[model samples]
Target: MRKLGTVLAALLVIMTAGWAGNAEAAKGIVIDGSTTVGPIAKSFAAYFMKKYKVPVTVSESGSGNGAKSLINGSCDIADMSRSMKPQEIAAAKARRINPVANVVALDCLAMIVHPSNPVRALTEAQIGDIFSGRINNWRQVGGPNFPIVVIQRESNSGTQETFKELVMKGRAVVSGAETQASNGAVKNRVSQTRGAIGFVGLGYLDASVKKIAVNGVIPSAATVKNKTYRLSRDLYMYTNGKPAGVVGTFIDLPKTPDGRRIIQELGFVPKY
Candidate 1:
């Protein structure tokens, strides 16, 4: 009888330890960086935490900050708008942090103008001129009589980098341009202010503002998937060293149908 009691107590101890281990494994996931990728990351974090019953937190400072946080071991995942730079990758390697990038979504830089503006499309060169302040009047682009109000993302913005690389080619965005923090902010300002032009992610588009076609090319999923959307870029989640635990599970999310649905419905293309 004493022997049986000992065995039962040992079993109870093992069971309690197992449960504790499982609880720790499902604790939480931390994500940070990239305002351009913020909406998508938030969406994924919400869905993932609810589905897996694991807590998750996400923050957006910028892609550079995200990469830095990942290298510093402060975040489980880092959201990014562009691929890692060579120097960033080298830095990560020095810290023994291998950043495995999982492409989660695609976004088109939706160049927006106030609804009152008649300019429905812009050539790439015309856009360059407008943002550079070389063309300040709407009439320069065969539009209204008002002068154009150029809006831009802050310099630290990942979207800004992508825009510069893909469109501006390192030429400075106009000196007096208004700089906003997030895509939503840019959309709101352009929506309410006539003659204002700004760029935002396609997910933020609405009838309140008009999205201009760049070089006669419309921003759409089909165009982006086919590599025709000139201002499109891939959204990424960077995990340190191929990931583990909740981070690893979340990284594999795009492989599921529900994940893909969320990606497309958010106005971004899914990584195939």
Candidate 2:
């Protein structure tokens, strides 16, 4: 009788583990990547979870990590501020992961300076010079007489990549520039440090820091849409192949009016 009881207990444990595994297989939608896009993804996750009673998790490591997660089958989707590179695409293809890109929003990579800097605008060339260690003093660009303190995003940032490609013209970011992990952090640094200059997504713009107009153009939807905002780029999500289940549903949700409103409320340009 004791032996039979022990056998029954073992079987019960195995059955329970199997059931839990199956249950987990049907659980949440996992999104990982770009810190610049994390807030938007988190907002969508919250709304989607509330409306559908489905679990959704969002992670903001960096765009590179996000693409890696998608290829590794570790996430349902990867939120990216920049487009996937060919190598990333090829890697996903090798993993039998067909990455399907969904353009969720348009982002303006707004350049920010300390509020008291007094430089209301900058041309693309000036920006490049600043980041490339060419422009070193605020007085050179109609600001206070102080040495410029350059701040930059970490190498993993999608926003950084976009900024380099668009504003830097493929030039390397200057050494000794402070590197921050997220857009919010960069904004905070720029806000607190006078003579400091940094770049962030449009959503991160606020009174603590002043946005510098690019080539006499502002970082607005109108300017971006009209191609005047040179630092604008489309934000995206890449799914391992065509997303099914909750991820697919959530991606499709943004096409609806309610989702569009959510996007707008979060300070992103609505795709729909």
Candidate 3:
């Protein structure tokens, strides 16, 4: 009778473990990547989980890591503010992963300064000079004689990449520039530091920091859509191959009216 009881107990444990595995598999849609896209992803995830009754998770690991997560099959979607690099495509192809980019929204990579800074608009050439360390004083740009505090995002950030491509024009950022890990971090640093200039996704812009116009073009829906906002870029969620089933449903959220509302509410442009 003791032997029989032991066998029954072991069987129950096995069944419980199997049940846990099924639960784990049931909670499978995972999203990871860009801090710039974090708010949108989180909002979409909340809507998805609430409406569909499926478990979903979102992580803001930066765009590069998000690509890595998708490449490694750890995530269902990799959110990115910039297009995937050539080498990333090679790596994905080598691993038999076909990455398909779905543009979820649009963002104005806003140039921000401390709210107290008076320098309002900068020409493209001026911005290049400032970020490249050729111009280090706010006085050089018609402002007070304060030393410029140039803040930038870390190398792993898609926002940093887009900034480099658009504003830097192949010039390396000044080595003395301060680097932060995420959009929020950069925003916070710029907000606290006088004469600081940094860039962040438009969603992160608020009263805490002031935005500067680029080349006389103020960032707005009309400007960006008209191609006058040079800092505007498309936001993306990449999937392995084309998404299907629930993955398709989640990826397509940005196209729906509710998704568009969420995007607009978060201060990002919708890609209707």
lDDT per residue as tens, model 2, 91-156: 999989899999887888999999888899999999999999999999888888899999999989
List candidate 3 stretches off by more than 4 Å: 1-22, 25-27
- TM match of model 1 to true structure: 0.88
Once fitted onto the true fold, the runs of candidate 2 whose alpha carbons sit more than 4 angstroms away are: 1-26
lDDT of 1 at 50: 82
Residue 160, candidate 3: C-alpha displacement in angstroms? 0.2
Off by over 4 Å in 1: 1-26
Between candidates 2 and 3, the one scoring higher on TM-score is: 3
Tell me the lDDT of model 3 at 90.
92
Candidate 1 residues 18-82, lDDT tens each? 99976774468889989878888888889987898887788999998999999998888899988
Relative to the unseen true structure, what is the Cα RMSD of model 1? 7.9
Query: Which 10 consecutive positions of candidate 1 have the poorest summed lDDT?
Result: 21-30
Please say which candidate is ahead in lDDT: 1 or 2.
2
Each prediction's TM-score against the native? Answer: 0.88, 0.90, 0.92
What value does the lDDT take at residue 269 in candidate 1? 85
